[model samples]
Target: MDGHHHTAHSVFPKVSTTGKKGKDQKSAKSAKKPRKAEVNYLPPYPTGENEESQEQERIQLLTEAPTNPNSNLTRDVVIRCLIVYLEESLDHVLKRYDDADEDSVSQDLTVQRMKIYSIKTNTSDCPDDVGIVVEGMKVLAALGNFPRACSMLLGLTYAVNVANPKELRYTFEVFQKFLLELDCSKLSPKVNSLKNKTASLGKWALAK
Candidate 1:
């Protein structure tokens, strides 16, 4: 009877030790498990307020242009936006002219005259291009008097030189055609004599 009791007691200690070992194994596994990482999510589209802010930034950049032509600040900003604004205004005015109830001969006259001089002309569309040469001259005319227009053209000529060779050459050709097409009669008295002399020289060159 004593030996049987002692055997039962020894069995209980072995069972308790096994249970403790199992608990330790579970605790170690819990410690080894990794925590999940947090994630950040972003919206796909810009809000209306964000768009307005960007537009304001563009307007401010254009209005307060820096004097330095080589300013790095202007590199990423497209100055063509200004040119586009000017072109669109020209398009609007030209559209008004087209919409006027004039004879087809009078209507077709401008396009025909431009077609004769344009390196690349578009005649098929509703508002077909008279080439950049004619379009630029029209813009100059729409801007009112001559001196301001000349300054604008000279500034653009300088600016165009900074572009790629293809753009530079195309713009130069447009200016060359424009100079050839310029009428001395439209010039203001302030610049008339000087511009007439310059026009004569240009005509001489174009004759070559």
Candidate 2:
């Protein structure tokens, strides 16, 4: 996004007005583009490469990567890449199910089973938290709205066998008193206390 005009300019490099280096060049040579610099998408997006061997690996690092201490930049990248992953995940699913025979079995083409990842090859010192998607849930996380993100996450999990984010567990907890992460089997010892406290807040909020 930030590089749109720059990309266009590269495709059609400006005529060098300095000397014969510009004049002697043929039209094809003038139109030839230079190599692109690696993009880090630091302000809110990123992808360095992809050699993932498992579906889980595609998103493992992105979810568990430390949330940037700079939430501002993290927020921005999260919002931007969220869209990328949503669109890209669909793109991946479509490509995977491109066979003509699958038309008879549309359910197999559904994207709920798709794993998310940046298809980006050009990259540099990328922030760890950057990635593309868990779909609707993916986009919500990308939008920097973790509460909504959590809601979609839980709903998606219950719908399909969507995996819970292992590293960023707090982002999707139902309440501070008790989390509903599927990976965690036992309820917190303090859950009852937390439930009471949350109930108290609600009761006080509705005081008559």
Candidate 3:
């Protein structure tokens, strides 16, 4: 009985040593394991540096606009040397006065305005063309040639359903309101929309 008890006690020490060796092996393996690297997630957006570069590109485009024909800032000066030539050419019905009548003065002014209209009807295909045409007509009116200005516009209308020049909304206020008091419903949708806005704004601004 004594020998059996001694043998059982000796077996327990060997089992405990095996468990300690396993624990030491597990600790060493844990120390050898590599740590995962932390990842950095960022939002996709334009930073300050990107924004500055974009701004610089925009400014470069603006600086190179002088030679650009499509630029709105392009200067379109009238030919100064031809001014005198045009003015002197306004002599109509001077060779014979017998053919003149009460309408001669009005008719003569109309002829002069037509001369100006000939120059204004250049029909610039540029986006700023409408502004140029409108400015010329306004100048004609200012120069006491309103009839000729009206005549030039009427001449354009003869075309079958011609489109309003670039920026139809702007052309509406400048040309249609300045010269013709035509029915608004007949104009382009853009022009009609602009007129609606103007009417609404006018009504809004009006005091009760």
Candidate 4:
């Protein structure tokens, strides 16, 4: 009976050991495996040289700027310069006409006519104003129509006096040079009489 009891205890311990081993296997199967670690990636940053090159390109573009035609020389300045040159040339011709002697009349007239042509050619496209008045005087002078020239001069003086006092003085000075230099004896009787009247008027008008 003792031998049989010992054998029964040994058998019960063996059964329990086998049951524990089976439970351990089931627990291992149900558990999850460990996951791989996650990786993060970032974009490459610009180097110092690349940044400097980019800045230089921007500066080069700014340095080679284009010109603006509208911003260049204004229309008013061009008009004023043209007027001043034309008036000066007219003064020169009138002086030559007055100062030339009897022996030089033919040469003087030819020279004066050429100057008139030049004035007309240059100012043909000019808009009306003092310039047109001066242009008319040149044309009359070229035609040897001293009476018409005197009339134009008188009109110019009046226009200048009313328009711009500063320009009036300049116009009078130029007219005086012409009158003072012209040969009074060579002029037609009508022209001589009109010249005297216009000279007197010009002086009076410019006095103010």
lDDT of 4 by residue, 89-199 (tens): 334323323333445543444433212221222333421212122322332333222222333443333323223224334433333333333112355444455567778
lDDT tens digits, residues 1-208, model 2? 1133123333443444444444566654675443323221122112332223222442442454355436544654653454353232223321221223434323432344433322212343332232224532233224223323333444444334444454333333322114332323344444444456768999999995
Q: Write the per-residue lDDT of candidate 3 for residues 9-104, one digit (tens) a residue.
A: 334332222334677878765754222221111111123323345456546644554446443232121222222222322122011123235366
Residue-wise lDDT of candidate 1 within 1-208, one digit each (tens)?
1122223333443222233458787876675422222111111112332434545654554444444434423431322232242232222212223333345424454552111111112343323222222322332223222222323443333323222123233232333333322222354342344455767998999999
Candidate 4 or 2, higher lDDT: 2
- Indicate the residue-level lDDT of 180 in model 2: 31
lDDT of each: 0.32, 0.36, 0.33, 0.35
lDDT for residue 15 in candidate 4, whole number 0-100: 24
What RMSD does each model have against the real structure? 32.4, 20.2, 37.2, 48.0
Which lDDT value does model 2 have at 52?
30
Which stretches in model 3 have alpha-carbon errors above 4 Å? 1-152, 155-183
Identify the candidate with maximal TM-score: 2
Indicate which candidate wins on lDDT: 2
Q: lDDT rank, highest first?
A: 2, 4, 3, 1
RMSD of 2: 20.2
Stretches of model 1 off by over 4 angstroms after superposition? 1-49, 72-208
Native-referenced Cα lDDT, model 3: 0.33
Pick out the ten consecutive residues of candidate 4 with the lowest summed lDDT: 36-45
Write down the TM-score of every candidate. Answer: 0.16, 0.25, 0.22, 0.16
Tell me the spans in candidate 2 whose CA falls farther than 4 Å from its real position: 1-147, 168-186, 205-208
